[model samples]
Target: MLPVLPLFVLTVILSVVSKPVVIRDSQFNLPVVRKLNFTGESTIPELDRARSQSILKRPTRIVHGDAARAVFDVAATNEALQYVTSVGVGTPPTNYTLIVDTGSANTWLGAMKPYVRTNSSVDTGQQVSMTYPSGSFSGEEFTDRLSLGSFNVTVQGLGVASRSIGFENVDGVLGLGPANLTIGTLFPDTEATIPTVTDTGFAQGVLTAHEVSISFQPTTEEVNVNGVVTFGGNNPSRFNNPISFVPLTATSPSKDFIGINQTITYGTSGFPILANAAGIIDAGTTLLLLATDTLQRYLTVVGGSNEPDPETGFYTISPANFARLQSLFFTIGDTAYEFTANAQIWPRSLNTAIGGNPNTIYLITADLGTRSGSGLDFMNGMVWLERFYFIYDVGAGEVGFATTPFTHATTN
Candidate 1:
C-alpha cells in the first residue's frame, strides 16, 4: 500500500527530473539534436518550462480484472519516447494500452474512463482519475504478441493513454518491474498464458520479474519505438563494459514508488554523494532531478552562465564547458550512477526569438520551476538520470544505480 505522504514527495521528484550525475562530450555527431541558435521554427517548449506550468495528469486507477500485463519503457535511438502502443495479455485474454513506465511497477489501464457517460461525455481527452493528485488517463488495450531483441511473448498487456500530464501527446504508461499492478506477476503460474520470465532474459532464466516474459510491440507504420529490454545480458555487441545488475529491494515488486527522499547511489564507490536527494529510481522516468541549489551548481560546472528566458526564469545551457571529460556520480543509499562520455548534449533547434533576443544556447534547459502555484515552488529536474540503469529495490528501502554504455559527440 502507498502511504499518503510518501507519494507527495515522489510526485515532486518524479515530476521534476534533469539533475544528477552526467558526463558531457562534444563528439560523435547524432541527428537527434541540431539547432544552436534557433532560426525561426520552434516547437515543443523545454521540459523545465512545460512542467513548471502545470500539475501531472497521472491516473492511479485500479481496474482489477484478468487482463493487462507488463510495462516497458519504449524509445528510439533518438531517445524520443514512443508513448502509445498495443499488446495482448493472458490466454483467451483482453488487451490494453498501458503507460510504459520506468518509475512504478503497476500496469493499470482505464477499463473505464473518468466520466459520467452522459450524452455530452466524449471518450477522448484525459480519463486518468488520480484519486490521489496525479490525474486521470484515457486509453484502451490491444491484443497482440510482443517482442524485443531475441525474446518474444504472446498476448501480453500494455497500456495506451491519450491524455498527457506533461507533454502534448502522451498515450499511457507501462510499469516495468516485477510484481506489477493488478494483472502482471513475476511467474506464469500467477495467471494463464503469462510465460515465465526465465524464458525471456534474466539470470538463470528464473523469471526475474513476476511470472511473465515482458514483451514489446514490433515497429512498423510509425516508429513503434518498440524494442526489447533483456535482463542478465547487456548486449556486449552493442556497448562497452556494460554492468551486470539486479533489483534494489524487492519488497516493492509492484509499483515500488518508494519514499521521496530515498537514496540513489551510483557506481561501486557508493558513498551517498548527495544527501536525501529528492529523486526516483523510476524505470518510467527518463530523466534525473536536482534541487535549485544543486541545479545551479551543476550548470556552472558544465560551463553555464545562466541567461534570461522570455518565459520568466527558464534558461538553456550553451556549449561553454560543453566538452568536459568528466563523469557524474549519483548516490542513492550505497549505489552510484555514472555515465561514460555522456552522449549528445542536446540537438540544436530553431526558435522565433523570444523577447527579441537572438537565441545563443546549444542544448541546455533552465528554469526556476513553480508548482502547485507555490511562489518558492522552484524545483529539481530529471535530465541527469536519462542514461543509467536504475534499480528501485523496494524490498530494501534502498535504490541502486548503475552506468550505461553512454557516448557523446566531442563537437558543438
Candidate 2:
C-alpha cells in the first residue's frame, strides 16, 4: 500500500516572489526524469485501454483558451510507460515529479508527496475534483507559484489533493490538455475554466507562442531520459522533415482534446487497417489503441494470436510470425508516417519489468473497446509518439507531426 497523509499539512518554508517570474531564456528547457511503477503484479493492458477510453469519452463542452510553450526534458519508465517531469511549486519551490498528460486538463499534486504551503500559497476556498479512468482526486483549489522549466506562473491554479486513488509513486499530473476540460472541476464555480500552465504562461508574456511540442525516442531501458517537451514553439533540431499541420478534428468528443483525423494502412501492400477517422494523440496513454474493428483488421494482416495474453492483455506473436511483420503507415493530412515493424513490438529488454516472459513478443497495438466511428476511434499513445515529433498549437487549433530520427529506427 502507498503512504497516506492528512488532509492538510504545512511542511516547507519559502520566500514569496512576484507572480509570473521569467528567469530564463525565451525558449527554456527543463530536464525531466522517468521512473517505473511496478504494482508487484503483472501489468494489465485491459485496464489501460479502459482508462484511455474513459478519458476520450469525457463529456464534451465548448470553450476557448490560449497556450504557451517552454522546453522540458522528459523521462520514461518501462513498467508504467509514462513520460514525467519535475515541476516546482510555491515561492522558493518544492519540486514534485509529475506525469505529463495531454488527455486531461487539471494540474494537481499530493498523491505521494503532500503539498507544502509557502508564503506564496493562497487557498482559493474552492473545492476541486477530477476523475480519471485509472484514478481520482478531490481537493481544495489553490493558486501559487508554478515553475515549469525557467518560466513561472505566479498564480497558477492547481489542486492540493486531500484524498486520491490509483496514483502511486508520482506526485501528480502536469496537464497539457485543452483548457475547456477544466470547466466544472471546481465546486460552486462549476462554470469557471481554469487556465492551464501553458495558457497562464502565455497570458503573462512569458511565452511568445501558444504552443507546445514533444520529442520522444524509443528506448529499451527500464528508465530512460528519452524525451523532451518544448513549450511555446517547435525545436527545429528535433526533426528531420518539415512539420505537417492538420486542423483539429471537429468530430464530437475528439475535438474536446488534442484530436486529429488520420488513416492507417499496412505496409507497401496498402492493406487498409482504419479508414480516415478522428482520434487523439495523447501523452497520458501507453499503448497504440485502435478501434475494435480496426484492431481486428490489423491483426488479420499481422497474423497475431486472436486472443490477448492473459497477463498483459496484448496480442502476442510467435518469433516466426514476428519476423514476417511489416511496417504500419499512418497518413495524417497529406504525409504518410511510417510505423516501423520494430516499433510495433514492446521493448523486449524490458519485458520482465511488466511481468511478461522475456521470450514472449507483445504488440503495443491494442483494441480501444469500442468499434470504429466512435468519433474518438483511435488513440496514438506514447508508443506511437515515440517515432514522431508532435506539436499542439493551441492558438491555431491545429496539431503538427514531423519525422524524427526514431521514425524508422529499429530501437524497439
Candidate 3:
C-alpha cells in the first residue's frame, strides 16, 4: 500500500525544489575605448565606399516588433577606423576584440584570434558564412555563453570562424544591426534567422527594453576612450536635448538597414544637398557619404578642389576656402540638426595617420558612387554620428537622435 502526502506538504516540497526567477537590473552601461590602427595607407575612401555598397546589397528582413536593453563598452580601432569592443565567449569566457557594426548582423570571430571552445559551447554542426564590404568568414554555428559587462546571455548563437579574410588586428565583429539581417547566414538552415546579441539578451530576460543608445565625441588623438553603448534603454545623461525619433523608413534598400528619412541642405543658403530620401545610419562606415550628385553639389557650393588628394583620396581645400565653409543642416523628422563647418573637415592633427600631409585640410563628405533615387542614397557614418547622440530601437521600428556636447563643438 502507498501512503499519500497532504496537499500542503506536497506544495511545500515543490516550492523547495523549484529555482527562483532572477530579475536583472533595468539597464547597464558599457564603456568603450578608441585605438588607432592606421595602415599608413591612403586607401580609406575606397574602402569606405566599398563597405557602403556592400551594405546596400544585403537582403532586407522586415521587422515588426520591439524588445529590451543592456550595455557594452566599445573603442575606436585604427586599422579600419572603427569602434571595437571586447566580448567574452563560452565558459570561463575567452575575451575577443570585435568591431562594433550597425550596418550588418552576424556575430562571428576567429580573424586574428582563434576561438576557444569550452563546456558552455555547443556546436550546432551548421555551416555559417557572411560577407562584408571589407571581409568575409566561414565557420560552424554554435550556441554558447556571451558576456558583455555585467550582463550574460546563457545560450547565445554565434559563428566560430574556420577561415576569414580582409579583417586585420581584430578577432571579428559584434553585429548590432537589425536581427533579421542574420537570414541566409547558415547553410541547411537558410530560412532561419539568427537572433542578434540584443535579441538573445532580451529573450533571456537579461534586458528590460530592446533598444541601444550610442555616444561618441570627436578627438584628434589616435586612440581615446570617448564612447559608450547602452543596451535595454537610453542613458539620459548622454544628450543635452530631448531625443526625437522617427519611424524606420519603409523604402526598400535603405529599409533593409537602420534606415531613416531626412534632407540635407548646405549652410544658410538652404540649397538642397539631398532632397527627402531614404538612407542609413551606420557605424561600420567611417565617413559621411552622399549620392554622387549630392557630393558634386556640395563640392560646387563649398568651392574646394574638385580633385581628390592623391594620397588620402579626400577633397582638399586651402585654409582660406575652409574659413568660408558653412554648416550643413540635416533635417530629420521635425528637427534641423546642424553639421558645423568644423565637423565637415577631418581632424588636421590626424592627417598623417591616414597618409595625408599634416598641413592639408581634408573634407569628410565623400561620394557614395551611385546617384540619387536609388532607394538608398546617403550614409550618415561615424564622422556624422560623432556629433550627435544616436539610438536604434529595433522593437519599435524607430531611430532617435539628440544634440550632444560635441554636436556643435569645433573639435576638428
* Per-model TM-score on C-alpha atoms: 0.47, 0.89, 0.89
lDDT of 2 by residue, 196-257 (tens): 78777766656656667888878888665556676656677779999999988889667777
Cα misplacement distance, residue 64 of candidate 1 (Å): 18
Quote model 1's TM-score.
Answer: 0.47
* CA deviation > 4 Å runs, candidate 3: 1-42, 62-80
Compute the lDDT of residue 60 as modeled in candidate 2: 47
By summed lDDT, the worst window of 10 consecutive residues in model 1 runs over 1-10
Q: How does each model score on lDDT?
A: 0.31, 0.74, 0.73
Compared with the true structure, the alpha-carbon lDDT of candidate 3 equals 0.73
Q: Where is model 2 poorest over a 10-residue stretch in terms of lDDT?
A: 3-12
> Cα lDDT of model 1 overall?
0.31
Candidate 2 deviant stretches above 4 angstroms: 1-29, 38-42, 56-80
Residues 214-330, candidate 3, lDDT per residue (tens digit)? 888788887666666776666667799999999888787787788889999997879888999988888767888889998998899898778888888888878988999999999
**On a 0 to 100 scale, what is the lDDT of residue 143 in model 1?**
30
Ranking by lDDT: 2, 3, 1
